[model samples]
Target: MNFTDNLAIQLKAAGFSATTDQLSQFTTYYEMLIETNKYLNLTAITDPHEVAVKHFVDSLTALDDKDLIFKEGAKLLDLGTGAGFPGIPLAIMRPDLEIVLSDSL
Candidate 1:
């Protein structure tokens, strides 16, 4: 299965739902991350599955508390957001909320 399909499956298993378009965003994000890593040294985890689980899934853990994470117009700030980590994925998952990704480097 492709990255989107695999990500969808994993999201479903985690009690989260992602539409095809949302999954496509994740796929695009993943591709960009990997591509940028070639010169920027963004992330050490390059394997697709590792990125899916370690980066993507781990980031979604913040959504376990829907009350806090999904609050209308909520703003989330991910400090030191290397590779966009939880910020990017959270933004994709909860478009309603505002996410700010900041890094010192």
Candidate 2:
């Protein structure tokens, strides 16, 4: 299976059911991240499976609660969201949230 399939499996294993569009977005994000990292040194963990588990799945782990920590339509700020960590993933998971990603650079 390809990286996308691996990502979907990992997400499912973590109890996340990402929509097709969300998966597409994540795939796009992953592609861009890898492409950019070639020049910008975005991340050290570049292996596909590692990125899937360590980055994407790990980001969504915070939402395991049945009652989400943030209220609907809440504005969230991902401080120091380097290369869009939990922020981007959270936004993808909860479209109702208004997330702002920030980084020093």
Candidate 3:
């Protein structure tokens, strides 16, 4: 099985359903992250499996209670969203959740 399939399995096992398009986007984003990290200090998780297990899986954990209290057309502001953490993932998981990621230099 390929990375996408493996990712699908992981997400499903975690009780999340991601469409093919969403998974594709996740794959692309993950690949771009790894490539960009070659020149920048983006993530400390270097290994591919580790990045998936630690970064990706960990993000999914926060979604446990999101659906319970999430309001329609809710606005979310992420301060100091360096490298796009919970904000980015939240945006992906909940497309309806408007997000503004802020970073200061």
Model 1: runs farther than 4 Å from truth? 66-69
Clashing pairs in 2: none
User: Candidate 3: misplaced stretches above 4 Å?
Assistant: 66-68
- Least lDDT summed over 10 consecutive residues: which range in candidate 2? 61-70
lDDT winner: 2
Q: What digit string (tens of lDDT, one per residue) describes model 2 on residues 28-65?
A: 88998899999998899999999999999999987896
Question: Using lDDT as the measure, what is the rank order of every candidate, best first?
Answer: 2, 1, 3
**Is candidate 1 or 2 superior in lDDT?**
2
Winner on TM-score (2 vs 3):
2
Tell me which of candidates 1 and 3 scores higher on lDDT. 1
Give per-candidate clash totals: 0, 0, 0
- Against the reference, the lDDT scores of all candidates come to 0.88, 0.91, 0.76
lDDT accuracy of residue 82 in candidate 1: 85
Q: What is the lDDT of residue 88 in candidate 1?
A: 92
C-alpha positional error of residue 30 in candidate 3 after TM-score superposition, expressed in Å:
0.3
Sort order, TM-score high to low: 2, 1, 3
Residue pairs with clashing backbones, model 3: none
Best by TM-score: 2
